[model samples]
Target: MQVTTTADPAEFMATAGDWLVREPVENNVLLVHALDPNGVPPGDREPVFATVTDAGAVVGTAFARSPYRMTISDMPAEAAVALAEHLAKEGEPVPGVNGPTGAATAFSARWTELTGQRVGNERAQWIMRCTETTRPVNPDGRPRLATEDDQDVVAEWFTAGMRDSGLSPEEILRRTQHMVGGQIANQRLIVWETSAGEAAGAAGWNPPLHGVVRPSGVFVSPNHRDGGIATLVLGEVVARALEDGADACVCTHFLKYESMLAVVEKVGFRRLVDVVEHIYE
Candidate 1:
């Protein structure tokens, strides 16, 4: 297998767009940042993209932005190893890897073998997809787009939801702002509010790609945890996603979050795959 690397974001998208689009939900995070059509340029450290070809056909792809996790498609073990070795030799400091569990493990192991950096299983999450709309038995509120005034609250909730992650507070704040801002700009950040004008919960979906919309950043404040507020909010988001022309609505929640998992399942989302994040210092 041969891995071709590129520094030009446009070139990488041109080369891997079709491949990534083929499995939009499964590759949602990668495509959203890599193909960022919002005219956002790469940060101080340029993002790197790679395509693994075997016998003249692209078999896998990867994207790595410094100080952030690297993401790869479900590639063969050999291809994973090749990509790892290439990144290691190129002196790329891959803080972590995220993708299909098997592929991620394969790449993480190879990176450890090559660079002597120990790998830790950071987290695992389930990728769920919904094709039909679902509604709570007794929906309490309607879903609406979040306004700019809601930014601070939305960012706070997002940051709180990420508390268990390894990101420093500063990193979390930056990421939350970027994510929430993007969702707001796209008018995709949805808020479910009570009749009393209280925001009970919120959820958002990435801009649709290849007919698929990825549900993300679903969170309910601690005070609103009970009474199935999350279900009503997520159900509305999924239903709207379908009505908005998305052929599928996909999402990921930590495997250990049984409550969220049940909510998604109750909303007609079928589990597709388990994604694991492997981190290396």
Candidate 2:
């Protein structure tokens, strides 16, 4: 097996796309593609690496977008150990993050073996899927799609959502434009308003693919919390997704979102994966 680096984002994305189309669930190609497309340019960004066998078959791949942070799709235990050792020898400060718990644990263990840094506690990520339809009963307000003129407000809300979720502002902004453009193309934003025509809460969903759509930026202002505004916002977004032919919709919430969890559960969403956000220190 040989690991090679690529500087062209387009080529990397193409290769990654081919890999994903062949093994969608196994490789997490969609998530990586989305991140890469929305990521900032590699002016100073670390180069991405593709792993392939002697026969030129791609096996496992990883990329270091930011210094001290690496994201991997898959890797064997021995290859992971080798990667860790190589990074350690180069004195690279690696903080690993990814979906595969086994690979992550093995990599962390190997990193410690080489660098003497202990692994930290793992946090939980809940991947929730929408299973049933529960439209909001109180039609006290109408849902309106956001327009291009609303970019400022939308950007502010997006930044707030990212900050609330502990994402980097620069990275979030780079991704937000892509997400917002998608929202506009799909007419995905829904705003809950009061009888006075004031915005109470808002939510956005991307276009459906493979019968699935993921909702993003579900938020209610502080003054509007606990009044079922979030529930209304989510209901509108789910309804939109379903109307667009989505058989299912997904959203993620950290373990801390007790209220959000309850709202999603009440609306017929099921928990799928306990996702963890592993940050490199």
Candidate 3:
């Protein structure tokens, strides 16, 4: 197995585009970045890209924006270990790694051996996909596209949601502004308001890449719990995404976020895989 690195986004895509496209949902993060390298969270710097090949065919891929964990796609255990060892030797300062549980386990173990950093299992989440929309029971109100005037409130909610999910303080700070700015700039941020015109919830999605779009930043305020507002808003979000030419809508949320899980499933999303994230400081 040989692992080659590339800094040029186009070059990395050209090398592993086919493999990633073949399993776009599984490689959603990489696909989104390849389409728009600036799409990731802020404070993300010094991108590291690697394509693992055996007998001259692409077998696996990995990416990291330094100071954060690496995200990797499915690969042989040996390849995963080699990639971790290679990155450590190359002086990569990664805070953690995220991927399928088995692959992350292998990579984190090897990384520990190489760097003496204790590996900590951070969280587990589920990757879900919806190919067909279930008719959503629209509640009392309509979905409203958030406007510029709503930035402050929306950013607060976005940041709060990140914090609630146990995202690191550094990550929450780094990403809040970009998350709010990008969502509004892209016209993807939305709010669900009640018949009384009270904004009960908000959610957003990235632009479609490789015919796949992932919706996130979904939140319903505490005053409005168990109202099916999230279901109403997210159902529309997923439908609009697919209608906009996305072949599928993908999402990954913490397993502990039962409300998100319930709403997504009710709206026709089927669980694809459970991903475990590991951190090595």
Which residue window of length 10 is worst by lDDT in model 2? 34-43
lDDT of prediction 3? 0.81
Residue-wise lDDT of candidate 3 within 78-151, one digit each (tens)?
A: 88888887888888777888888788788888988989999655788878889989545565888889888877
Which wins on lDDT, candidate 2 or candidate 3? Answer: 3
Per-model TM against the reference: 0.92, 0.74, 0.92
* Clash number for each model: 0, 2, 0
Candidates sorted by lDDT, descending order? 1, 3, 2
What TM-score, to 2 decimals, does candidate 3 have? 0.92
Candidate 1 per-residue lDDT, tens place, 121-158, comes to 57888778889975554546667899998888998898
- Prediction 2 TM-score vs. true: 0.74
Q: What are the candidates' C-alpha RMSDs?
A: 2.0, 4.0, 1.9
Off by over 4 Å in 2: 1-64, 67-71, 74-96, 112-121, 164-178
Error of 1 at 126 (Å): 2.2
Q: Write the per-residue lDDT of candidate 2 for residues 73-119, one digit (tens) a residue.
A: 55566666666666576565565555455556667777877876675
**Best of the two (1, 2) by lDDT:** 1
